[model samples]
Target: MDIPLPTIAVVGLGTMGTGIAEVLARAGREVIGIDISDAAARRAARALEASTARAVGRGRISAAERRAVLARFRTFSDLRAAADAGLVIEVVPESYETKLGVLRALDGIVAPSAVLATGTNALSVTRLAAESARPERVLGLHFFHPAPVMRLVEVVSSVLTSDRAVAAVTALARELGKEPVAVGDRPGFVADGLLFGYLNQAAAMYECGYASREDIDAAMRLGCGLPMGPLALLDLIGVDTARTVLDAMHAASHDRLHAPSPVLRQLVDAGLTGRKAGRGFYTYEAPGSAVPVPDALTPSPAAGAVPGRQVASVGVVGSGTMASGIAEVFAVAGYGVVLTARSPEKAAAARERIAASLARSVDRGRISAGARDATLARIVPAGSADALAEVDLAVEAVAEDLEVKRRLFATLDKVCRPGAVLATTTSSLPVVACARATSRPADVVGMHFFNPAPAMKLVEVVRTVLTCDEAHATVREVAATVRKHPVDCGDRAGFIVNALLFPYLNNAVKMVGEHYATPDDIDAAMKLGGGYPMGPFELLDVVGLDVSLAIERALHREFRDPGLAPAPLLEHLVAAGCLGRKTGRGFREYGRR
Candidate 1:
């Protein structure tokens, strides 16, 4: 049975509180919105009105519905008005004294069964609950900032929180049209505990000048498919808030990973709190907007080979997944493509797969059937590299063996026209070695695409020392032609994305290795707390243990750093043939469904 929607009161009409109130009122709940003063309350009320009005403008809400929502909200100057409310969500400042005061006041006025919830993102829900007379009734309703827009809300329950309280609040969250994941009360709960640590470390890398801010941000946004770069997100979340949460998490976890970043504190001290102060990691046009202008001090783009532009015909060798994906990407970009396979049967199968994928795109309304047919028409399948003679660009997405790649490039050089750009989609092999395979080393570059190439947007255009300036520019142009974000980086073992991303993933594995948390807990913490689409363990399974281990091994070999060594656990999984979804087993058992 559905619990009746409670007469909800959201206390403290601050940024988070107002947003929460807006969500409740918009959801047809009878809401009481309160603040310390009338003026502050009015401003929050106005903000809510504007928010709903915009929803109406967007046709998300009818004008009549918006008016009804306004009528449902009641503003108050006194705290006692919330006494009869079945639930009071406290979204006050993140201070123990302040929260304790709110709870103690609510204890005296609220009915015996009324639930008291706090919107603390990282604070200990248990400690906060203990401040109330009825500890079991107190729990956390951790909502992301701009609560109405972000879909996730972590429903946190302390050890002392009552089962009924958790269940009721979880139901309430669903009523408000949000996805609620119940989590244990802990420092940082599920999301921020893992997320802030990663953000703090990324800041550390930026501070040390390991890479430029743009490159660092691009590495995640473009390289890893994150919604935003860490630095930019740090700014949006506010450096001050980040510092406070980092300090709280570090103090509680006692783990060095949760340490507060020094740069965060320094920026806070400089009054560059974040969007609130109009500055932080990156300058924002306003407190809550993302229109970013390049900071004059922003680092220059990393040095790399130039890409050539005159390519009219492209050759994609190999009919495996990557090669088929490459052919599709180029074909859709309107380039004449020669797709080769080891045998005619394999080439025919690859063409069928590509056509099926394109048909699916048409079904989803992303492309017209005619356009799909035209794109497929651009690809001419062949049985050997000999047909690549007239191609201006030859990209080998073949198997990863070094000798196999060397042999492919050597054959391409013999058959392809002079001045043809040679590229490799190898994620781990050194670009310099691939370049050495070609007589025109200056034309060979790395055009690394993530798996399921048609869907992923990043293309790491890696340049070797010998690669010409035109080669790098040409790669960037090709990336743009294929509608991908091109990030230029020098020849490094794992390049930018894997170099930074794998280490963090490995650290999470290390955390599990040390028995800090179960695999489910770790993954849940990241997805719920950090807002990542998938958890580290889930992503590990998708990427395959063998592939990840190979990249880790390459990084370790090149850097000779013990820290970069592949985890023994990962190697054991690979040895067991539990290589993620492909093998239906890995860190977690798959195929059970």
Candidate 2:
């Protein structure tokens, strides 16, 4: 039975509240927006008018419809305006006292049959409901930021919440052209449960000075295809609000990763609460403005003053897809590339793979026929590492096994001439381990490239304690030459991308293993709510669960933090040989190719 909820009131005319009111009014429902501050109520009114007017100008609504939308929406500076509302949604600050007080005061005002909802991404809905006068009528209606634009709305119901109230709110969400996902009353339901932990870790990564703010932001944006970097995202989501969410998550589950970073508290205390205040992790153009201006944290492109070694020729080792892709990237950038492997036959095949890849680019109009032929001509296939003697850069793209990479580095050290930069593309292993295998540790650095190197724009330039300044600069310069965004980091497990990425994947697996949510629902929540390019499970399958598990294990071993432990289900799947797309079955089944 889907109960109808037509007359709704949104208390607290903040950004979220105003957005919710707009959505309700646009859906042809009566909306009453209330706030304690008259100025806040006025701002919400103006914002609604501007938003609806823009909609009409875009031909989405007629001028008559815009007027009706405005007529159905009204604002007041008192809670009494919500007395006739069938549903009252509280989008106030994230405080137990503040939320509870609002619920208690509204309990006596609204009709007994009226439903009440709390708009909280974090915080216990059950606790809030239990303290309200009509516990059965209370539920959580968590809308993502910019509620009108975002399609996801988590319809959270506590144990005490009535089925009628849940039905009423759920139906209203669908009627408003939003996807409603019913969830149990928990601190971060599903999307935020996985999202905030990753955000917290990113904040911790930046706080410790492991990577520059710009590099961290660039790495995630280009590396993981995220909409924004963690610090910039934190600034966009007020730092104080994130701290509050983290505090609630930490108190519920004592996972250290959920513990708010010190930088968050420090920023909030300084009154630099993100874009709303003109500063947080970055300085915005103005209060509530998205435009970003230069600040002290912004990195200068010329900071790497060390001049890089001149490179005219490059050597790419191994016969895998990554090797072929790297060879193609350098060849297209006008560098002479020697493609070599342990056997001449394998090296020839790798070069042919690059030829086919370039041909496709020509077929698709990405490159001209002459350009493809010329790019293929630049690649020289060889069976021996001796061919790399004249190359200025020898990048080892061998197997991920540590010993294999160490042995290959040692081989490159013997074959390549002195002053030649030796680089390894091991995603999880420490570059220093491979560096120690070679006599010229100072000449070795990490040139970690993403899969399909020719397409992905990110390259994590990892530097070890022994790597020379020139070697580091050389990799950065080459990465730029190949049109990849290079972000520098210390020689550590997972570098910048995998270090922050795998943990989130592991937690997603845990959520499913614990029966909290299904893969489809979790996937939809992230794509619709968080604006991620792909859901965690979808990416895990594409990345191969086996490889993801290996990276997760490496991270856990390095951190020794209990929270970083690999999810048992991941190990079981790998043990059962249900590796992702490679095996045709993983978190979900895809038919055999």
Candidate 3:
């Protein structure tokens, strides 16, 4: 059995409304597009004709189909024109009073059996339903920007919303070629709830001088595989709109993470709303331009170069995954590498791992067989710390334990040449703590790499207060030699990525604990609305709930900020041994081999 497509009435001819009307018309539905101003109605009609012509030009639709689609659309400036519509959707500004006014007006004009919907991202659908007489018929059909292109539509159902009403919209979404996820009526629903918190945190990081905007964005793009950085995404989604969503979510949950950063308010106040206004965190070429040029506020990349000693040969100490990856990175860059492990057996295991990794790279056409052989030839495996005697640099990538790392650095300080730059690949523990362990504190630096180091491009070059200009330059130069993007920062708790990332993940856990929305819905919201590569829970599962908790705890312990504390849900999950994919369970279940 199939449900009949309804004649749709879209009240409002703004960007969202016009896009929705175009979608409906293309789907062969009789679409009545309404606007209060005559000029706005005329403009929408012209826009539709132009858009359809472009579609024809792109060969997306035949000229006959374009004419047919245009004939299905009817533009009007009066509300009574929708009296016969089976469904009426209001797509006005995201303001409670404005939407409520539109809904009340639609309630009087549409038939008693007609379904009423709003395209709101953050407002309360339940409260909006109460304003109409037929509350059971009211729900939310939230389409993302450029509704015709984006495939997601959140079919939100309030407590008073009838299942029949929800089913109607869900079917309508499928008819119009959109994916619909059923969500409960709440502020920001699923997507904005998890998204704005992350964006707000990025703004705070920039305001605090934690890192430059470019570095902050690059960290996420290279580190997490996101399509765009948070700051740039914020610019795409206007600053004023982001603030409105954040204010609404904060009002509902009272979570500090949702509170808008002061810089956001200042930007909006300064008329730098975003791409729509021509200037934001980054200035645009013109209003509504997608391309962004460097603004006066862009921070310079890495302080002026320092005259440092050349790094020709490197030593990597450990038997762990990170250690092997680091050794491989250096060897492939034409640097002689000495990899040391505690025993002959462990050294053999590290060699095998690196060999298998290189073999895979060769099979994938990422490197030639000759290049792989040459890279492997550059690595020298040793079973003792004495092998690092003459290397220009030695990096300790052993473990996260402070005592273990400190012991290695002390040994390196004793064995390596005095001018050799000693670095630690610690992601959480302070670089200075490692520096204090070595005799040559001025030569100690931090080079933090994301997992699967050979593939991920980011390397946060951390410098302690005692680190000399020469040491910093050597590490930065090495990072560039390995074709990694280096961002310099002072010794800090989580560096840039973990400091900004973990808190956002922790907030998602709290949202789940509070029963605000289902995990799947939250994940879909973030992916569809924010264009993130993965949802917070999905990432938590992949990274391991236990590992995430440890990082969050370290962040809280160092900063003493209550907001950074690990969520109770995370603690319980870790304690219950639902570690993640390794344990076959975490926030979601996984199939084990």
Q: Which of the two candidates, 1 or 3, achieves a greater TM-score against the reference?
A: 3
lDDT of 1: 0.83
Ten contiguous residues minimizing lDDT sum, candidate 3 = 1-10
lDDT of 1 by residue, 338-399 (tens): 99889878887888889999999999999998999999999898888888999988899999
Candidate 3, 258: how far from true, in Å?
Answer: 1.1
Using Cα atoms with residue i matched to residue i, what is each candidate's TM-score against the true structure? 0.80, 0.98, 0.95
lDDT of 3: 0.88
> By how many angstroms RMSD does model 1 differ from the true structure?
4.7
Error of 3 at 51 (Å): 3.6
User: Better model by lDDT, 1 or 3?
Assistant: 3
The superposed Cα distance between candidate 3 and the true structure at residue 580, in angstroms, equals 1.2
Per-residue lDDT of model 3, residues 302-411, tens digit only: 46656778989999999889999999999999999999999878977897799999999999999999999999999999999999999999988887999998888889
Candidate 2 per-residue lDDT over residues 115-174, each given as its tens digit: 999998898999999998889999999999889899999999899999999888888888
lDDT of each: 0.83, 0.92, 0.88
Worst 10 residues of 2 by lDDT: 295-304
